[model samples]
Target: MSGGENSSRLIDVVLDESIGRSTPDVEHERAVAIFDLIEENAFHPVGDEGGGPYRLNLSLADSRLVLKVTREDGGDVVTHILSLTPFRRIVKDYFLICESYYQAIRSATPSQIEAIDMGRRGLHNEGSQTLMDRLSGKIEVDFDTARRLFTLVCVLHWRG
Candidate 1:
């Protein structure tokens, strides 16, 4: 397909309901910043096996992001951005998604990480399930990948 066709195809993927969760205009801006943060954070490749030249393509709306994981031979894995909730939530969700996908790719996957300590434990309860648990059946996310992501989370700061 041509660029125009691909562009149209991308446009068809609706943003996840997370964007609608933003309560205020300021929250909306924070969501955008979180998206940018995720985009920037995504530049680094994850896991040794499926080494990417991971490429990110932002969708039609600023609400979602598409990360295309590429191989040395030019093969690729296309991941659609499903959600971008308000404030700190998006940051949590994005990294969890990436880390979980990364971990799912591993030969040995960790069980799950849950949120405790009033969300201060740094564990992100993005959805009802851990990104690993959800993506585990779909992909393979191992320790190193998860660790890298956890580390990424430590460094990810939302700018107002």
Candidate 2:
């Protein structure tokens, strides 16, 4: 791929297995988010000289979020370490809403299910915006990309 085409997107994404295994629901969400993110996203590491089509590895260490980026050929690019403190409450609340949404899908009326989903989506968007704000000068990503990344971040926070 040409540098321009490759420079602004991620070709691969991985979550650290050390974090903990996820439930089936979380696994499904992780798969879909990675697929959607790779299919289309705007991810450009600011001040990167190698250009992109980057490979991103998401992990948590020392209670912080680590975003390790690399070139398509596995060359080193940049690693961003962000605090998890800002995400704790959002992630907690998001999981709660997600649980409600999942439960609603099984027994609640369509309207109830929709209402719960709306709340879940709102939280997701909020998380996305927070991520974007945090990455302001490090990694530039569009809102859609941020949303998918937020899902992956939640996957990292998944304890079960």
Candidate 3:
């Protein structure tokens, strides 16, 4: 497929309710990430499926990240389950940096805040790259899509 072929992308995304409770901030973050993801993303599932506007459900079950992908009308496409072990360290670091970034916003100088935010973005990129690596052959997603999906994964890790 060519670059301008209207690559498959998500039409709707749902996170399982069993993922556990979330604070308002976490919820807001999730909302923004999902909104951004669906607004503009590149998600092309492997195999011939005539391209798609897919629906994805993300959840955690038995310590594994469960990704359930389907067509817009609910036809099953693929289910990808990935272990959480690989993401543990990066997610932990991401959360810690996020906390610091939030704090830095309160009293730190502009430069300090910018530096912390840069570190946060760096870690975020690392996490997203890890996700893309893990998702290889399962589904294809662009960097920005991976980044947004990484945020959702980190949100799930919050309860793990």
- Model-by-model lDDT, in order? 0.38, 0.89, 0.86
What stretches of model 3 exceed 4 Å from their correct place?
A: 1-4
Better of 1 and 2 by TM-score: 2
Q: 40-90 in candidate 1: lDDT tens per residue? A: 332333333444433333232464323444443445554534333332464
Clashes of each: 10, 0, 0
Error of 2 at 156 (Å): 1.8
User: Could you give me the TM-score of model 3 versus the true structure?
Assistant: 0.90
Which candidate number would show the highest TM-score if scored against the true structure? 3
For candidate 3, the per-residue lDDT at 30 reads 79
**Candidate 2 residues 1-160, lDDT tens each?**
5557757899999877756677897788778878988988999999987787899988878999889999989999999999988999999999999889989988999999989999999999999999999999999999999998898888767655
**RMSD to the native, candidate 3?**
2.7
Sorted by lDDT (best first), the order is 2, 3, 1
Error of 1 at 157 (Å): 6.3
Candidate 3: lDDT over CA atoms? 0.86
